[model samples]
Target: MPILTPEERIGQVLAGRYRLESVLGQGGMGFVMGGKHELTGRSVAVKLLLPSYGAEAEIIGRFFQEAKAAASLNHPNVVDVLDMQIDDGEAFLVLELLDGQPLTDLLEERGKLPPEELFPILMPVMDALAAAHEHGIVHRDLKPDNIFISKDLRGRVTPKVLDFGIAKLTEGDSSVETRTGGLLGTPHYMSPEQAQGHKNVGPSTDIWSMGVLIYECLTGDRAFQADSVPALLLQICTFDPIPLADRAPELHPAITQVVHKALARELPDRYASMEDFGGALFAACREAGVVLPATLEELFPQHRPTIAPGELSAPPPPASEPEPEPVPAPLAKKPASKIVPMLSAVAVLLLVGIGAGLYLATRPTPTPPPVAIAANTPEPTPEAAPETPPEPPPETPPEPAPPQDVTHRVISEPAGAEVVLDREVIGEAPLAVTRPGDVASLEITLRLRGHVEQTISVTEESPEEVVVTLPRRRSGHRVDPVGAPALAPR
Candidate 1:
């Protein structure tokens, strides 16, 4: 069969239903065409595997893998794979038509985006990744080009993840490794393990890629860059990128921390899952004063637990109490007196006769003699008042002196070299180290592989940045060998 040009292929009907309208986009493996369903009259996008790649088993598998992986996902931020079919030896997948453009185009248009604008686009993307992670799917290749920003029917911004051609399913024996030509993922976006060509990569790989995407979106530059793929891979594997805050100084430190955590060199140091990454990203954006277009619930929908038949009944109504009988009032008590009233008149006469007989029997008693009193004991003199010592005046603490602004910028001829301060390794070169301003001077040591170590003392009056140019190390020979030239530092 003769190959048809893209223009000639336009209007061609696939699967007897989707009619190709125009070429929407094209990539190395396939072409995405604008199409319409003839029977339903609904617009859609058709992804066709390139004719040249159709016969290759791996390419064909990936093409179908994209459909299978995407179709399994049901998220507002993930592209919907509607139908897939093979016609005339070419495989195609029908997807929901997106109105807007890819995130790469947006980044090209706007050099760098502010957090307020960037977070809205990325939060949903993170949510979609979180969902994919829950389903045990890893988008091995995640970058701006694979992210699409569209406007829904209500004109709200919706960012959708596209092209799961290289997605890795983490279940059973169905996992497909796409490490072709010794490289599995994009060098700039790959984590250290992925860049080093590790066989087992999980959700943390995607998290690292998302961190790179966020760094790019904020700084309009790649997190890692090199002139060649090998150099880029080496950097990803062994070197640290410049801090996000240094690249985008206006960004909040919390935002920088979030990105840094995602891009940690070690897997253990990185975010464990996309959910953690999304939570941290949302919190950082919120703390940075960037208002997201959606709330956390909208970004991360909570899974409602399944309720059984008897689980969701309304609480029984409170029991009503019976009315109590009225309390009876107590009667007033009579006043008591020492003498009884006329009721006891007979008893009183008997008591008075007894008292008169006692008074008649009692006669006059004899008086007792008085004793002599002792004389004069000297009066005790008043004790002298002890003196109260005055308390020493409260000493006023000396006022603390203001701290000095001791910020030193360290730069090396070849940037990204290791910087050591006071025998302790600080961050990489081309970074600012703020020490206690009270120090008279800071001893900074710069070290790079294949270069001689250089040390410099930075004082308060020193220039803003201490620039050090290190000489290349020269190898020493115990004995001169034939054809060996003299060694000298470069």
Candidate 2:
């Protein structure tokens, strides 16, 4: 057998699609190469398995298995697989070209991470896990080496997950999603069930691993440490990791609660879903006053119960009716003397009324005289029409459009700046922001990641269109301007 030298590997085209440019890296499974598409000229990363590993049935199966697993997912955080093939008995998969370092290498260079530092890096991974779990997929091996951190077109930090070879497709009748388990995952991050080689390893195992990873990120030390892999597995199976607060006293105490809940040994005691675990961790971070990107808000959407459009709210309880006011007792009967006097007056009045009527009826009736008619009545002339009043002279000439407010197109030199008017976000640049009608001038603020925040006042003197150059923010100085979010995270 002959060794595959770097010179022989470079400059070769694969499947008439990707042309190898250079070797990016090498791992136990295979070596990855930087390649470009021959037709579209798009940059790509090509991972080819060594013939020695390809010769083994299990290694070869996992290589092709990675293709199928990654191909099944369609998420921003998961690496995109462009093509997969077997050439001359060696298997290789083509993936999207990533422009950043792996999380493992990053942790090595920069030891422990703080809340503000860890938030943006961990959020996308949580979102990716949530998305995968939604589709009955769980990444059994989720360590730092598998996570990649990169930046997007807007200079926003992005975290992507790579290598889904050992990922378990969890869709079956068993309560535990997986039945094929033999101490899967690294010893330091594996759950008790996984360490014991139980066939019923489920999503909680992933949650447990994430908790261990979080602790490591915060302390730069593994939760469980031992001299040998076997001893480490024994500790993970029996003992609980030390509290995070004890390890890093400066860290927020709320995170300790999150770590405890997520790393609970029992499935029922642990977080039920990935969304729950991730949301709790971020929520704890927020409470501890950590500076997190605004995009983290989307991770925990309010679960509003589904109601039909025509459904109506229950009617208010019927108002209680007031009882009728009690009537006063009738006054005592009037005296008999007063009653008799009244009766006498009534009789005399009735007799006088009868006599007057009789006299009027006896006096005879007089006859009305008859009218005489002329042979022909002359026609009367028609009346003249009434005149209409004149409308007031045309209202004072036309009035001009009100100058109460004006709109200015706000733009940044590098563009995509989040615009704020009087502390309220209007939109992202290049966008039009109108000054409020009540205020003559407004404090317009423009903010972008990796750029200094600029707040200026827009008055009648300000130009209709304005552009401000934003200086790049130096490393270790994360900017969180008050306005809108510059990036929409996965």
Candidate 3:
């Protein structure tokens, strides 16, 4: 059978309450369409898998598994899954229609983002992952393309994580089987373990992928790149990524450290949970003085604890009440006038005797004698000899001078045009730069290893400053071209 045209695709979606209006987009697995629910008349996005994959038992299982995982999660940052079905050998998913662009599209236009701007976008993505992870779901394919930046009615940006078709459920055994040399995710964002064909991946795998996504978003290049998939895999396994500061110097050291830790080749070294990762990322952003839009809950949903039966019920009421008041008494008083006159006469006689005694105690006494002075004429001649030569004061040693202030800035660069700087890496994007007080001559060196170093000079104006727009190295590697593959008929 020939590939179904747009009209044929729309006809396939019209069987149920959904009425297809136009083509939204297409990818390796399927095409997304703009549609409306007939009963509710609400706009929705319908994703129809290609006929070839829809008929396969394994692909069908994976599709349903994705639907189940997504259905179990209900988060503001996650795209809502309305329904799923298989009709006439074509499987499709109905999702809440979004009015925004994928992060991938934005990245294509702006190679990398400043730390101040990158965290706001990343926080929500982490939040969506945290929600899915809580529900025992791992979004195995967590690339920029799977993240969308949509706006609410108030025009505030809302990140919606999409495409869970390749996500794995952690509660039970994997429902779908894998083929050798047949990985289930985008090559650029897949973790080292995933690239090595390991099947027992869990939340850590998603964490690794998220690390790569953030690395790419801040540096304008994937964490690992090669001429082919095998080379990329080798790099992911053995190579230490170029420091983020070398790419985006404006990012704080804490921010770069977080990104590096997330991309750690070993899963144990990475963050334990998406929530942990999100918190670190957010904290780094704040330390760098970058303001983010959403709260931690908005980025990572809070776990709702389950209450057992009869745990929070109210208690019983009171029993009774009772009575009255009472009264009280008085009396007794007597004379003071008779005692006053006798006491006054005694007090006057005592005052007269005390005044005479005080006058005799304070009188001054007479002075007495002075001794004779001894005069020696010989003592004056000795002083005149000492005045001839006064010994010079001992020379004072000079104090050691303070150490010269050395301003250090490390800059890292990838492909395209962005630079990252860090004093000492702590966690995520937006590194801090420390400079000397006096206008010191600052050297900005761009290193993309295997490429020539581009050195430029800047004045030390601010202690912690970031410069984002920088020139790219002419000799660095370019992105590989994506190609279309042929799909078999249903």
Q: What is the lDDT of residue 488 in candidate 3?
A: 19
Task: Estimate candidate 2's alpha-carbon lDDT, on a 0 to 1 scale.
Answer: 0.71
Flag regions of model 3 displaced more than 4 Å.
1-3, 11-13, 169-183, 297-490
The TM-score ranking, best first, is 2, 1, 3
Error of 3 at 321 (Å): 25
In candidate 1 the C-alpha lDDT for residue 311 amounts to 26
lDDT of 1 at 240: 77
TM-score of 3: 0.58
lDDT at position 471, candidate 1: 46
**How would you encode candidate 3's per-residue C-alpha lDDT over 17-40 as one tens digit per residue?**
678988998765677899887767
| TM-score for each of the candidates | 0.59, 0.61, 0.58
lDDT of 1: 0.72
Model 2, residue 411: distance off in Å is: 11
* Candidate 2 structure quality by residue, lDDT tens digits, 377-463: 888989988988888788687887666777878777557889887578888889887776655566777888755677766666667
lDDT of 1 by residue, 1-490 (tens): 8887677899889878779999887765568889888877888888876677678766666567655766666566778677777676677777889988899999999999999888778877887777677766788789998899998677877788988634452111222224333333456787777766577778898899999999999999998999988788788888778998788899999899999899888889998788778877777776777776433433433321233212222333334855678976653444445345755887989999999989878967668679665688578999999999999999999999898777778777556789987688888989897767766566678888745677776666566866666543322113211122322211
